[model samples]
Target: MPSIARVPSVPAPGDAAELRARARGALLGLAVGDALGAPAENLKPSEIRARWGRITGYVTDRPSGTDDTEYAIFSGLLLARHGSALTPAHAEAAWHAWIADRAEGQFRGAGFSERGTLENLRRGLAAPISAQHRHAWSDGLAMRAAPFGVFAAGRPAEAARLVAIDGSVSHDGEGIYGGQAVAAGVAAAMAGAPPITVVASALAVVPDDSWTARSLRRAVAVAHRGERAVRSAVVIGGYPWTDLAPEAVALAFGAYAAADGDFKEAVLTAVNMGRDADTTAAVAGALAGATQGESAIPEEWAAPIGPARGSCLPSMAGHHVLDVADLLTPEVEEGVALVPGTDLEPATDLVRETDPLRHNAWPPPDPTVFVLAPDQDEVRP
Candidate 1:
């Protein structure tokens, strides 16, 4: 019933202030969308209310993550501690740290399907992954991948490398590509590029020959084609009701296409598209948030997207959310190495010749939160 032309507006100018605002806005968008859809996971938006009832408002109190959001937040925490470093040794330390935390029940509340991560941690079977089918390879890797893209804005490839590492622990192939594609979108958005161009950069890393790539490729095509695009995706992209990945991508395509470059429309369109609505909405919202910032998220939705339980950023208190740019300071102490979360062994030889300097990586000042035994919270929150 909505006009297909209702696209969200991009932020004003490309000033650092604007860019930072947009980045924080995107993070908020990611959290909002993530939390909104939390109650609906595998259900269709329609079935969601029946199954879990209306989510009403911030059901959790602060933002808590399923695997997608958790992995991304974890990646951010890793980067925050190390500044901008990505060395193999650092990578190993990170994973070892994550494993130790698991032993201590740091991630005890980790979601259902994500229990696989715990399995991997228990057995130490995860391999060093750079590309394709590295591990679990599920959509979770792609779900919260936008932040990395924002962190590596202006450096799409750098963004991809970070994605490769973060994803190596749990995703592979099209799964990784999904994360890469989304990350590229965020990076380009932060860099102030148009949707058309941002998507193109994302495609460069997403295998143009695969299912994920095919969906995105077709989505771009539909953005210009309209109803026919929808038809193409349903026929080729598959329905989300069948599974979250395909159906989610289909809705993402329609939302992105219809929004043109508008973040709100992009998200709403995805939400309205039905199955996996929450995640589809989140993906579209993140891309849009990256493009437009907090301003792009309609004021109507902002009020309710606050202080949920399990939120990593407890400062949000009980009912608050950060806008874009607020996430950026050019000043968060960028270098600190606490416990590492992912394995660096396999990527060792491959990364040594190409590891980015290890600059940001640290544990939360809340040592009580994670399971890192030997790791004490050196800094206070």
Candidate 2:
């Protein structure tokens, strides 16, 4: 087992409300991005352009999140119940209880990674062995990683650790790295870190030599150049699956970096890039939202995002992102009055001080070719 860092203490009462709002922004932004990008998922950029012409807003008449939002809800509720003590066993059990053990009708909008995991579980396989399916490296884990960041608040390392625990039940290698990057980025954003710092926090958690890290570095390096450059830098051309963990995670972070943490631009950039649009946009939305807070999200964009309809996980039905945010945020004690001018302590006091980008070498190593998943006719939504 990897040595874990100390978990940060919960925020002070004055900061609690602020943290809660950011958490709400992170989760709500995820749902909004997921819905807005759903219509563009699996389509090529040209196809998306032909159909919706840049997807400035929802393309569908009644826009709603697909598997992305529901999976985040599933992870959020599980994190709420377990807190920082979550383990691989707990995650596996939850899969069995809330997913695999349920009737066939209950499993509706699950992505390939999830469906594969459920099948393996029903066949009596336990994780990380159960995670051996072909699509184990999909962006499924990355899509749900924001909740760990929301729960850990300013603690990026701890957030990464917790998300890895969650991912262990269904992902491996680049898949786990993808989730770690997203979680760490969101955690840094929650701490009010700048966009560069947030990206650095993401790079800190995973091996620098991994495909996910390499692609992320490439994407962020050219992010300022423009969205097209960033997408072209990271996307693996000719890969059949749009949900490749390394490519999607890089594109999402690149979008966030390109927009400088602006919620709308970050999500819209990701959505228009087209590959795994829902997951990438959801990740970008979560990072930007955590940084900017709920009020930063456009009112009209926020309006359509109601409680999740359990399109993917039936056990998560009727649970709104706000509800999960509230659950993840620690509440102030009753009757405890907050000092109006109380200076909130810096997060450095709670978390260990370490160079987040120690492993990031300038001019990232030459890109390495990886084995792509076997081409399948059905792409994950």
Candidate 3:
């Protein structure tokens, strides 16, 4: 099992309190989007109403984000508790525990990318992590890159690079690039920057070697011109499972650009547009949640997005947006031991920090609680 060794989490230069607050905002942004966008995943405004009759509650299906947001949060919590990121190995160990216990870890049964990745990891197949796991390319990367951005606030390049490796574990091509772009945005948010700049920064890091990047650039270009959704998607070729990362990324960008910096509006716009509803929500959710903060999510729409605060769903990943941010506070940075494990000759491990395009990480992380199935006694609305 690949191992994520412990390393120092250096804070960006700023008033420590202010930095902590921004970190919280970024973290909250992910959860709120994951929750809010989830309910609107599959249906457009019309279909959503036709099917669910006016989606005022948390839409469990869409915001599910195939568990992207949850997994990202889970990684962060593990890092917070253990004080470093997980190597592929550590992540695998966590998965094994889940399988053994029927724990159904966070986003475990979501879809193709995760399923394939886990199977390969379980077999101890030591291959370099790359787009190979889900060779066809998928939206898995787009959803889970936010937490990495938050944790890697000061190192945008590092964040982008690291997330790409993470993405390769279950994604490839445009899918991996999507994770890179999203992580870039989160890093920008963590740095207390504007969304446009963050998104633009992300646009730059994605490789120019493919059509997805072109599509992403086109989407960004037209985001300000008009209703970016219809124009960008149709003109720029947005469609679910089309092997197009930019389309989804663009839709998210257009919604973000059109919504007057409102998290709710951005997510609503994406959900209302249709196709890849959940993944779109997952991507848009991570971006918007980073910008707007958890408070921006409506109370009425909050419940079905997933579980609420204080719930114990092992599969849901341990922390909600709120819990995640709280973990990054200025006060939380004291003697948390910047390292993750007991001891790895820091001298040797430190030198191996260059980010890999993918990972074949081993050693397996401790089991993570993907969702905490609620008990009947506490099932009140």
* Count of residue pairs whose backbone atoms collide, per candidate: 41, 0, 40
Model 3, span 1-381: residue lDDT tens: 111112223343334555555565555555555565555554445676677664444555443323645666555544443333446555444444433234454445465666776667666653345225643366666766776776665445656766665554567677777777777766665555566666666766776655556666666666665443433343323233432455666666666666645667766666665555555555666566556555566665554434332222254433455555555332424344222222221111111222111243322243221211110000100
lDDT of 2: 0.80
Clashes, model 1:
41
lDDT of 2 at 295: 96
Q: TM-score: which candidate is best? A: 2
Q: In what order do the candidates fall by TM-score, top score first?
A: 2, 3, 1
State TM-scores per candidate: 0.67, 0.85, 0.69
- Model 1 vs. true fold: TM: 0.67
* Candidate 1 error regions (>4 Å): 1-14, 44-68, 87-100, 103-113, 129-135, 224-250, 311-381
The worst-scoring run of ten residues by lDDT in candidate 3 lies at 372-381
lDDT per residue (tens digit) for residues 222-320 in model 1: 666553354345432333232334335545655776788687667655644445545666777777887787787766567655443333322112322
Question: Which has the greatest lDDT?
Answer: 2
How much RMSD separates candidate 1 from the native structure? Answer: 12.1
lDDT of 1 at 115: 52
Error of 2 at 143 (Å): 0.3
lDDT of each: 0.52, 0.80, 0.53
Model 2 TM-score (2 dp):
0.85
Tens digits of lDDT, candidate 2, 102-135: 7633445377888888888899999899889998
